[model samples]
Target: MNDVSFLPHARLDDLIQLLLTQGFRVIGPRVRAGVIAYDTIDAATQLPWGWRDAQAPGRYRLEQTAGSRCFAWANGAQAIKPFLFAPREPLWQARRAAGCFEVQELVPPPRPLAFLGVRACDLAALAIHDRHFLGGLHPDPYYAARGEEMLLIAVNCTHPADTCFCAATGDGPQAAAGFDLALTELDDGFVAQAGSQEGRELMQALVLAPATPEQRAAASQAIGLAAAAQTRRLPAPERLRRLYQRLDHSRWEDVGARCLSCGNCTQVCPTCFCHREQDVPALEGEATVHERQWDSCFSAGHAWLHGYQVRPEIRQRYRQWLTHKLAGWQAQFGRSGCVGCGRCISWCPVGIDLTEEVEVLLAEAADGA
Candidate 1:
């Protein structure tokens, strides 16, 4: 069956209403805390309308635009990670009851969610999470339960951010799959196409018209321009084979000197899933609550094992993060951990670019060899 449809810009409200009526807790891009972020939305007014952001290394500022575009800006700091793998969650609780301890696991209630304005790189990150949490040797029950109820509505990027390098990673400028519906925003409306059965059913409620050749061509041209516009590119992946060989490389010290070890990069990274579990006892010390919170290798406590800290130096911690993200992850996951969304670049307090570091490190390694 034909999967393409055209929805005029004014009719976006209908789409939101349809999702709400279908019992999906809809979340979309909204302006909050001076930036665009995914949040619960009940109407079209809650979206980041006519808002654009200027982004650079360690910089972000939102500004009003004259256009009617709903998603002209590049991504914000937040991604879909928080929605699936929560930052902090209660796993189970143990209480003193019936002259003994009673333990009950607290699984989050499954709520169907529809994510709007999801970008291609973000979508790729979600797929990578699926591989780890769902396709791993033993699937995580919590992630699996929450992930299955999600509906993804991807938006094709027309304006690429200066820091964006999804094209170099072959992850974006356009979403290829794993979405219920994909939209390419044009001047007047969106060229929408279904990627799943549910998406087709949702489009029927919008009463969308058949897309014209002009609209389809405009969509293709917009993404093409975005792809060609990217300037940031990672160092050759093949060169990273010498990454472990350069363990004692002096570059680690250079990056470590400026690195604050703030753990912001891992927090913003959509695919970094390191977490630590804790048990908190009540004031009476009779009851305890088991919780899991996101953890990062940048933290000093991350290397704590038994009575010894394996990686006590900040340089060692930073090296572990970069090497794992760019190289070691390939050995474990059969794919690189980075999706090239550039959040690590933009969110760094010191504005350190991993792309630059990798390039320099690889070049030095080649020269030394």
Candidate 2:
């Protein structure tokens, strides 16, 4: 366990088979409908090998590369969020029976899942989610059931997209913790290290050979290159925390004018946790299923109070989201909500970049001072 091991490309499938033998359903990145997405995979061939993604503000395209590395791509549209924090789920059910109503709390059945190729930025976001969902006095049973038996296999990032800024967030290019196992992909294979007892046990089963000194050096060099290649970055956390002080900044209006208010940013964001709950009645009116679905601050109903809308304008809604994500989140959770994965920028229809907006707003503030 002291020395890192090398998992050859040829024996990569053995890792998947080992996980399956241990009662884990393996999920990994694969090409589906022209995009790299995380899905259930039973073998190594399902991974998006020899592929690279080109990403920018409001743009993403996947292209094939000659290299045979499986984890050469930066990221996809979705993170591991959906696996834990489901987009939609039933909360409870009420049945009308014998002159009384019976209520039953609903929780998903436990299923051991092994997530493969998790990036450092996403690992950071996942920690934030752990705080939100499981770190409260009234812990969420639904989130707990799914999270309890999960295994994370992190892959250090080697290909950062144009919009990536995890380096600025102090989250990535390398995964420091929160993984059972960590892998660094090289041309011939992956340099693997175990971070947990479960990972160490699995490593023994794989029977991998100790990684050579050159392979370890190459892995380090590749991660360094990825960190250097990132061109986008956020302002310092303290600087971003001051966003609330500039409520009347004209930049808000400028960005709001171009904003779509479509909620794509919240949907793609790994840490945004707004949701709304409602009851869906059965056709016969005999039973009702209460369900919770993801929501966004941009929605008109999100800020509604009694009968009046708290934030009627696009500028106000946008300001609320930015302030909470950068400032209020620190007060609530001791850190900013954004992990700087850049999904919000790439998935936005109009290509709104939060980092660019933060720089403009802070620059104007400094000029005024």
Candidate 3:
């Protein structure tokens, strides 16, 4: 741990201004369409000041807080994934020529961004994405280019949403690493600590005072209480493999029936990265545009093969998503796909909870064994 400093709550916007002065686009939590989501901001006044959110399975509502706290909400439907791996991007375009077609790969717009109010679970998800995209056998040039230079200013979650379970997964309430700067908001101000050279330089520019021992203790206490407050948890890590044994179990059919196959879970999932490519040809047959768009397992065409679909049933689709997220992902990626953010639970229109489904399967597998 590095030396900590005190950033007064009233001057929190100073950090935003500082980032902007350094030629960085600042993106922070803001209220839009009645929910808190990360959006671009030019000044601190745009942040969701004095706002908090209430979330549950298939439900979400926003309310005003009593004080002028900037980040009372735990999370919203959006995460930092959208910034790194965008929803829609043009891959390449082809134009007809005399005897051949000319193809060119499209480059993403260049912009260095600073993310604000990011939580620990979201940080964990970003790490998983980094491993999958940057550390893979074939590195993704698109992700590598966009994710390379951004600054991550993370916030240690002091308020855990009811649906949150990052503590159980050992991923959240407080971020231990993978951030340039981490913040713990207290009543009077924020206890800010730098994790990288950039963070240190930024803090020095702000000319903040060193945090007193008492303030540090208060920050620690705030994080501890947030961890203790989490009510949801995944099953034991060793027991997660049991999910594979119960693929044929009846629980999948039950959940599938209620699932609308709307793909809301994947949309809101912080770690999900499924996508498909499309080609748009010109009416004159002179040019064709190739674009990549986000896709989900719940979609009917996701499993299409050579004139056939692999998963034709909704139960099978649901099972594929669950099995991959909890069990198969570990085998393929050396880590669990889920970070326990609980966005999937809250955003699902039918209120499907992966944690509850895992419990049922584990119990059934235990009885059968």
Candidate 4:
């Protein structure tokens, strides 16, 4: 941990302006359509300054929020996987003119990026995905390039939705790692801290001033306040794992009766990294290209193969997804894939709260016994 640089309240925008001067396309959240979503911005005017969101099972909506609400918005429908893995992308191009087939490996887009206003839960999710994609049997070249060549500016959550469960897992409202820089919006200014080398460089280049002892204390207290304000909390991690092992089809069916397999839960989830692939013909008369797109297990075709779908039954798919997220992920990556960002809960059109679901399962299991 390097000595973090800080600046007076007035020099805040200068930090963003500084990143732009360095040729990085900085992205943060702003009000768009009916909600706040991440996008490119040049100044504070474009961000969701005093706004926040209301999320629940099968629902998500933004409300004119109060306070120094830089992260007033809770969770967005989109996550980092789409940008890192791309919903759909060509893997390679090929041509079979007369007899022999020719192929060319795809080179992904070169976009040096810096993500701002990111929450700690999202950071945890990214770490889980990184473990699967980069530390697994096969590494994705395209995802690796984007992930490896970017900066993370995490924001400690000042507001959490009713669905957030990160605190239950000891992940955060405050980020202790994986960020180049972390920012906490203050009433009079912002509190910035450097957790990595790149973060130190960012602060130095921006020429921000050193944080006062007061600012540091405020930042720490603010983070604790946010966590204490959470509305949802998961059971013990060991209990969560046992809950999965005790799954029963009848109870799952009752839950599945409400789940439309619309995939909003998985879609908004920051760590759900499953995806499908495809191939397309090039504009020229002689070539074809391979593609990779984001996939969700809840989708009907996700389990499909040559003749039959692997987990054709909806009940099976639902159970598999829940089990993998809460249990198998720990074994596979030594971390729970869920970061408790609550995107799944808030974004679901029908408001299917996962915490409630887990509790229901536990209750039913106990009653059955």
Please name the candidate that would achieve the greatest TM-score relative to the true structure. 2
Clashes of 1: 0
TM-scores of the models, in the order given? 0.97, 0.98, 0.97, 0.92
lDDT of 2 at 313: 92
Q: In model 3, what lDDT does residue 241 have?
A: 68
lDDT per residue (tens digit) for residues 299-340 in model 2: 999999999999999989988999899989999988899898
lDDT of 3 by residue, 1-369 (tens): 345899998778899988998888888998999889899998878987788888888988899877667877789998989988989988889998998999998867667889988999999999999988888589887888787669999999988788999999989889989999998988778999998989998888888899989999999998999899988889766678678888789888899899999999999999999999999899998999999899999999999999899999999999999988888888877778888899999999888888888888888566546
lDDT of 4 by residue, 10-30 (tens): 676787888788888888887
User: Which residues of candidate 3, in runs, are more than 4 Å off?
Assistant: none
Q: What is the C-alpha lDDT of each candidate?
A: 0.89, 0.92, 0.88, 0.77
Candidates 2 and 3: which is better by TM-score? Answer: 2
List, residue by residue over 1-369, the lDDT tens digit for candidate 1: 468989888898899999999899999999999988899999988888788878788887889988889999889988988999999988999999989999998888899999999999999999888888888489887887787688999999998787899898888989999899999999888999999999998888777888999999999999999999999987666666578888988999999999999999999898899999999899998899999999999998899999999999888999999998888988877768888888888889999888888887887667656
After superposing candidate 4 on the true structure, give the runs of residues whose Cα lies further than 4 Å from its correct spot.
1-5, 65-68, 282-285, 364-369
Q: Which ten residues in a row have the lowest lDDT in candidate 3?
A: 360-369
Minimum summed lDDT over a 10-residue window in model 4 is located at 1-10
